[model samples]
Target: MTRPGGTTIKNSRRLKVRVKTGKGRTVSQKTWLERQLNDPYVAEARKLGYRSRAAFKLSEIDDKFRFLKPGGRVVDLGAAPGGWSQVAVQRVKATEGKGKVIAIDMHGMDPIPGVVIFHKDFYDEDAPQLLIEALGGEKADVVMSDMAAHATGHRQTDHLKIMALAEAGFAFATDVLKPGGTFLAKVLRGGTEGEMLKMMKRHFESVRHVKPDASRSDSAELFVLAMGFRPID
Candidate 1:
C-alpha cells in the first residue's frame, strides 16, 4: 500500500497498487516498473506537470546555487524531453523577456514557451555553430547538461561513457561561457578525472561536485559545478 500524500493512482482508487508478474514481463522489467510506480518523485513530477523526475534535480541544484538568473543567456546541452529547459524558462523568465535559453538534443521535443530548440546531437560538427548562432554571438551566462550516454550494465563501462559526455560538455562550456559564467554537468561518483579537474580549476574560481538529495542513493551520479569562469584571452 502506498500513497502520494494520500493521492490517488492513475485512474485507480487504490492506495496500494500491485503489479503481478505477467507472461511477457521479465523479472527485472517488473521490478523496474514497480519501483517507478511507487517512486515519490515520479508521482510528484506527474502532479507538477514536469516531463521527468530529473526536473527536480536541476531545480534542487539551482535552488541552492542561484545560477539561473533573470536576463541571463543560457544553453542546455542534450536537452530532450525539456525538463531542465522548462525550469530554466521559468527561473529566467524567458517568456517574459527577462532572459534567453537555448536547448539542443538529438531527439526532438515538444516546444517550450521560452526556449529555443535545436533538434540535433551535441557531437555534430554543426552543433556548436548552431548554439553560437542562436546566442547571436552573445556569451552564455551558464551552460548546463544532464545528458547521459546510454548505460551499459557494466559499472566501469557506464562510468567511462558518462565521463566522456561530461568532458565534451566541459569543452563546449569553455568556448561558449562568458567571464564569470557557470558550468554544470553530471558525472559519476568515482570522481572527475584529475586532468579535467585541474583544467576546470584554472578556468573557474570554484569547482565542486554536488549530489542533490533528489538523486537516488544507490546511483553513483554526481554533478560538477564550476562557477566564476575566468576566460583567458
Candidate 2:
C-alpha cells in the first residue's frame, strides 16, 4: 500500500527472530537488535549501501517536498555516520562537481566522496564560518540538521535539548542560506514553540512539519521544513 510521502508499505510476513540473551547482552540491547533485524528499511539500506535507515527519512521528505536540487550548495549539521550527507550529495549532484555538500559533526565519521566534512562541535564560534568558507563564499541553498541530543529517557528534557539544537541550526542557517533557500531540522512533537516558530514564519514563505515513514511510528521525532527564505538587511 502507498502511504503518505510516497512510501510503499510492503505487507509481507516473515518469521520473527528472537534474540537469546547472552552473558554480555542486556535485555534492552537484545530488544534493539531484534528491532533492527526486523526493520525492512534497515535491510534495504544495507542492500543499497546507504549508511543508515535514516537515509530513507531524508529521501522520503525530499521526494515529497522537492527540495535538495541539483547544483545546489547544502550544509548538514551533526552529519555523523553520513547517511543524510550521502543522500544530499546524490540529490545535489555534488559528486559530479556541479554542487557542494558541507557536513559537520562532533563525532568523527568516515569520509564520503563529494562531501567536505568537519569533525568538530557545531557550538564552536568558528564552525559556521568554516562551512561558509568551504562554500567558497557562495550561500547555501539548503541547511539541514538531523541532530538530536542523547536521550536522557526524560521526555521533556530530551525535547528541550533537541529544540535547542534546532534553534541553533536555524540561527546558523539564516547567516549562510541564500535568499529563497530551505532550512530543515528535526524536532520532537511540541518542540517548535514561542519565538522560534514566530521567527520562522516571518523569515520564510512557508513552514510545515513532516514525519516520514522511515521514522518509527512511536517516535516523537518530526522534521520542520521552512522554504523561501526572506533575507533581511
Candidate 3:
C-alpha cells in the first residue's frame, strides 16, 4: 500500500488504474496514467506554479537554444492553459514593464498575469493583424507554436494536420519576425520532410529539431527551431 505522495510512481507500463475490472484493459489509458503519475517534470511544474508540465518543456528547449530573452517580445500560438505563456511572461519579465507576450488559442484561458491572451481561431483572416495591433504594432523577437490538431488516431492524417499548423505558424513568423528573430513550433519525431524543410531552409538561416527532456519519452513530439528570418519580398 502506498501513502499519498509517498514515493511518487515512476513511469511504468504496469502502474495503471483500472476503472472497470476484468479483461477490458486499455494499453493507451494505462500508458497515459503511468506516464502522468511518474513524470518528474509534471511535479516540478506544479511546485513552481506553472499551468502544465509543458511549461518545463519550453523552458528546457529555450535553455538549450536561448530564443527567449529579457525585454524580448514574443507570441505564443495555441496558448491554451497558458503554460508556455506563463513561462514566457516570467522569462521576459513582462511584469517588470520590460517586455510583452501575446498569446492566442481557440480554447478559452483563465487570465495569466502579465500575458495578453486572445481567444480566437488563429486561422481567421484578421487574427494575425489583430495580434500585431495588440502588441502596440511591434514586430516580435520570438514566436512559439504548440498548436496541434485533435488527433484522429490516423497517423498520416495527424501528421498532415500538424504540418499544416506548422506551415501557418511559419507564415506568421515571416510576416512579424524581425531579421534576426526566432521561430519555434512543435513537430513530429523525424522532422518535416521535402518541401516543408525546403521552405524553412529558404526563410531561416538555420533550422533544427529538438526533443526537450520535459516531453514524455514515448511522445512523437519535437520542436522545430528556426533562427534568423529572411522574409521574401
Candidate 4:
C-alpha cells in the first residue's frame, strides 16, 4: 500500500464494515461501498458536516505546508461537491471577508458560503476571462486542483489521462497566480516525473510530490505541490 510522503498509517483495530453482494450489485460497486462504509475519514467527514472525505485531504496538506493562509485569494478547479472549496473557505477566512475563494466546475453543486462559484467547465473559451474579471486584477495566492479523470482501471492509461488534467490545471494557474503563488494538482504515481514535473520546475521555486494520509493506502493518487511561482519574463 502507498502512503503519501512515504508515511505509514496503521489501520486502527475496529469492527470491520462489510457489504454483502446484493441483488444486481456488481463486485466493484460492493467493494467501493464496503470501503466507504469502513473508512474512518468518511465517518469523520459526516460528523464534521463536510461535503466529502476529500475535505480532510486538503486540510492535512495545508496543515503541513501552511499555504492556505488567511487573507489569501484561492482558486479551486474542478470544485464539484465543493469539498476542497470548503476547506479553502475556512483556511482563507473568506467568510470573514478577509480573503477570496473562487470555485469553478462544469457540474453543479449546492452553494458554499464565502465562495464565488462558476458553474461552467474550466475549458470553456470564456472561463479564464470570467475568473480573471472576478479577481478584479488581483492575482491569486493559490490555485489548487483535485481533479482526476474517471479511472479506466488501466494504470498507464489512467495515469496519462490525469496527467493531462494536471498539466492543463497548471497552464491555467500560470495565467492567474501571483509571484510566490502556489499550484497544487493531483497526478498519479506513474510518470509523474515526466514532462509535467519538468515544466513546473522551470516556473516554481520548489516542487514536491505529496500524498496526504487521507489518500487511501492502496491508491495511486498523489498531488504535485509547486510553490513560489516565477512568472516568465
TM-score of every prediction relative to native: 0.90, 0.93, 0.86, 0.93
Q: Give Cα distance to truth, residue 55, candidate 1, Å.
A: 0.6
lDDT of each: 0.85, 0.88, 0.81, 0.87
TM-score of candidate 1 relative to the true fold: 0.90
- Give candidate 4 regions above 4 Å deviation: 1-13
Residues 59-88, candidate 1, lDDT per residue (tens digit)? 778888999999888999999889899889
Which has the better TM-score: candidate 1, or candidate 4? 4
Provide the lowest-lDDT 10-residue window in model 4. 1-10
Give the best candidate by lDDT. 2
Residue pairs clashing in model 2 are none
lDDT of 1 at 207: 94
Query: What TM value does model 4 have?
Result: 0.93
TM-score of model 2 (CA atoms): 0.93
Error in Å for residue 120 of model 1? 1.2
Prediction 4 global C-alpha lDDT: 0.87
* Model 2 Cα lDDT, one tens digit per residue, 1-233: 44223445445356788899999999999999999888877777787778988888898899899889999999999998999999999999999998999999989799999999999988898887788899998889999999988989898889899999999999989988999999999989864454577889988999988998889998999889999999987
Ranking by lDDT: 2, 4, 1, 3
In candidate 4, what are the lDDT values of residues 1-233, reduced to their tens digit? 22222323235445898899999999999999999888877776776778988987888889889999999999999999999999999889999998999999988779999999999888887777788778766889999999988888889999999999999999999988999999999888886546788889999999999998899989988989999999997
Model 1 has an lDDT value of: 0.85
Q: Write the per-residue lDDT of candidate 3 for residues 78-194, one digit (tens) a residue.
A: 999899999899889998988899998998799999999899887788887888887789889999998889899887788888988998998888887888899999887444544
